[model samples]
Target: MSVTAGMESGPPIGVTAGPASDRGEIHNWTDLFYFFNHSLPECHVELSESTKRVALFVLYLAIFVVGLVENLLVICVNWRGSGRAGLLRLYVLNMAIADLGIVLSLPVWMLEVTLDYTWLWGSFSCRFTHYFYFANMYSSIFFLVCLSIDRYVTLTSASPSWQRHQHRVRRAVCAGVWVLAATIPLPEVVHIQLMESPEPMCLFLPPFETYSTWAMAVTLSTTILGFLLPFPLITVFNVLTAWRLKRAGRPESRRHCLLVCAYIAVFVVCWLPYHVSLLLLSLHGTHIYLHCYLTHLLYFFYDVVDCFSMLHCVLNPIFYNFLSPNFRDRLLSAVVHYLPKAQPRAGRRASSSSSSTQHSIIITKEGTELTAAGPHHPSLHFQAPNPSPISAPGSLTAS
Candidate 1:
């Protein structure tokens, strides 16, 4: 019942072809050379079914464990009163929540993959799992977009009236994001079904008459909404923010610019290949007859890139929270607060002294002050960084 068990007897997964009569003939020497060069290696370079199962299980399990722990820490550190007040912090917290949601769905997926794509769970579970996973996927990326925009606005806008109304604006934006994310996955809930023929499997199957059209539509929609639109916006805003900081001539602006570039690079490295594969597969589905070798390559390519895309859940916290000195300070304080009383007083004193030596000032362009305290003074205190409404960038705030 393995999904790949009968691959030689049928078309590859996620690919559909026209009839044999419509298949193109290699009528020239050039076509033959192209096939030998491009398609021959794919025939020999494939992993065994057992190898793929074990590799994917281990990969997803690691993502589940690490993503769960780190995202939970982010939520705990940011759930405190002071962390709840800022637009940037709010976006970070919500993004962590969305990443956690995706992590929670991994166990079920791991189980299904281990069972060779079997759907032991009923139809309702199938629909719900797909819905939950896609919703969080959309929301997580949308929050990153919001974070980029907020960083740009923080650097550019300094009006007192805007600051007064930011809380309402933040709430409205978060709510709208959640609403759109929830709505986008309705198709999954409606179209994903638990198939019982040949063997029980979960798949997206529409009416036979409209299968190709539906498949192409879904692929295009996901690519456009998930990557095509949001990525450009994220890049533009982050680049502009970095450029503005560089122009301000702050000592830390170079480092801030580098961090901004890192954000953009990671997003592209993780997502671009996956969306590209989706688009290529959709094109092949439109009754276009790709060579057998190219079809196989596309199938394998999709699998690899899809797994790579899930890595963002693991990387998000590191780039967005763990990189920040303030977040690290908060995490350490939280850990020390929960330690047992039997711990050595000498060790605690050592920690206090070490923390006292580490000091940094973070001044937002809007004049908001953020102070990270020593171990003895565990609470963070916020105030105005400068009397002037606009000031130079002081420290890079990790998104």
Candidate 2:
């Protein structure tokens, strides 16, 4: 979500154009500018500019290709069987779409980094690119939170009233999430501009009169809304979900519970470093007397972690869809459907075996019957007596 380009030689707004000698004495207004520009010449000793550019180009390219392919596969596979739509499927589809949005923006970002943070595109692109990236980033996080909450809710409560309105409620929640995600990036659209400083670059430059205050506000707000607030909610809900699954005393409950915990672990590993860097940058912007070396080090740290955060776009599909047994079955069915001749013998054997096997039924708290084909298929495939939807196995659902 932090799409701003690396700083060049330009003096950002609100910073006085002073001699190199004054660079040693940092002020609040100049701190952000210096932070981006890496005012200390010694910092260049860590990695040469050419090396950094090549490394970033490689990273962005890899993320773009892998994330694009993974999310597209998720969307394509899930898009089928619309008649069997369920809340978990809807969440997976939406989350894949969000991750795809983030992946699509990577090429432009790749080009920007390759050009040494130059913005060859004009003003409209500058705003739209940042807005699109941030919106999807937030939406992806929100959808994960939704997935967590849905897992916990379905596990603990089975009120007739709640079950009756569950689909409608989930639809409304998805719409609200999309709207909130779009709204959160409006400040970026306003503040981000194509600045033709030392070189043309897309940068977030607030008004000069309120530069420091605005910068700090934006940093803190993004950290809070994007990570701080949502992460705790995700952790709590997933933890409770895992706990409930463990108490269920089913054979597959342990594996299912660990998968649930993975949701929290992956989110934290991918996002925590980036938010910590943002907090450090925010602290530096407060004129909190950091040594010159430390300030430069922070800048480098931020750049690394910012790119590192993008691993979520790639990992989301693996965790949310590919890991689910039902989704895998669906994907295989889809593949075989399209390529009928590819595995005819195996398909026949599988179909015969599945049809002949006796299904074991597990009753939920609401007394809904879940039919499992055999021991090989650990998930209890939901078969509601009513029209309520059923979720894919291993998708935050206990078997």
Candidate 3:
């Protein structure tokens, strides 16, 4: 529906309950949904909306700027050396896109939250924003799983046939993951409708019975698929690799697992609370709706955790850039090629085929070091050749 036309006071078709409720207590728990979190936590206390607006705007703006810059830098660096990139780069590029897409949806959310959860964007945007949010959030999780699986398979398998098919298999799996994540949110988009709570609020209007059952199923499945299963598998692979490396008597530190550990840390720190809180709230949402005073804290906690989880996008680029020496080198290379002042040297470097050797100079807070090997090599405090002198035990380098 058109933005203006969608505001023509559509039917308050769904179940509603409780006195003076902006979100009426539905008699049953049928409206729980995976993507449609359009309801505002009805504040029982006198919380200042202005205060919330200021806090939200600060976070939204900070995340927008930081996530945009970090994601773009990683993507540009990857594509610049796109020709030489392997499956890992491909996955990283996809992850960046997924994270970026999710974070971009926040400005819309910020607008709605600022208005005390009244949605002004009408029907299509209401659905589209939720759709985009879930699509990318799920995609990021799936891509992370894909990366962990890639590492596991590569490390454990030794057969030539497995090696031969690895590239093709990786490409196919990655393609399937994106397509699947993109398709999963269609039902949420279709079910979302706008209703007036004095002002229009976008809501998921799935038949109440369908929500109590299938919607709950969707939420549980997300918890298991998005976090419970993949995260453990990723951890397992890292542990196995560490064990094998130690058995081989290699000097590589267990910190090599740090990249995967950082991934785990982001998921746990950013997402774990959101999922757990969402589950608790979904189960008791009906009770809370009836006894609004009793469960105000639950509602408040859910919104806070859910909103904070968006920071994963901002953190992902920082983790990859700082943790992976390769990412830093590519970023430096991209800056030289694209920045105005570095153009002269970049042009000279590109034109001379005979001078293919590249020197990667990394200046850290503590010192400066140079790394030489091909166009890209490890850099930062972790600079110097492989087996970096500065690398600590448990420190891992990107392949």
Candidate 3 differs from the real structure by a C-alpha RMSD in angstroms, to one decimal, of 11.1
Best by TM-score: 2
Model 3 spans with C-alpha error above 4 angstroms: 1-49, 85-87, 209-211, 258-260, 285-294, 341-399
Q: For each candidate in turn, give its C-alpha RMSD to the true structure in angstroms.
A: 11.9, 10.9, 11.1
Structure candidate 3, residue pairs in collision: 253-394, 254-394, 255-394, 255-395, 255-396, 256-394, 256-395, 256-396
Instruction: Flag regions of model 1 displaced more than 4 Å.
Output: 1-14, 19-46, 81-85, 285-289, 342-392
Predicted candidate 3 versus true structure: per-residue lDDT over 103-204, tens digit per residue:
777777666656666677777787777777778887887776776556545555667786567668867887898888878777545766675544676665
Residue 369 displacement (Å), model 2: 10
Clashing pairs in 1: none
lDDT of each: 0.63, 0.63, 0.55
Candidate 1 residues 1-399, lDDT tens each?
Answer: 112212322232234443324445544323332333343343554647667667767887999999999999988887763344344677777888998998898887678668766678788887777788888889899988887776667667777766677667877898999999999878645866666654566566556446556666777778888888999888888888778778878788888778878888888888888887667755764556566577566654454456667788888888878877667776876776666544223233563465223333332232234421100000000000000001124544542
Better of 1 and 3 by TM-score: 1
Location of the lowest summed lDDT over 10 successive residues in candidate 3 = 376-385
**TM-score of candidate 2 on Cα atoms, chains taken together:** 0.79
TM-score of candidate 1 relative to the true fold: 0.79
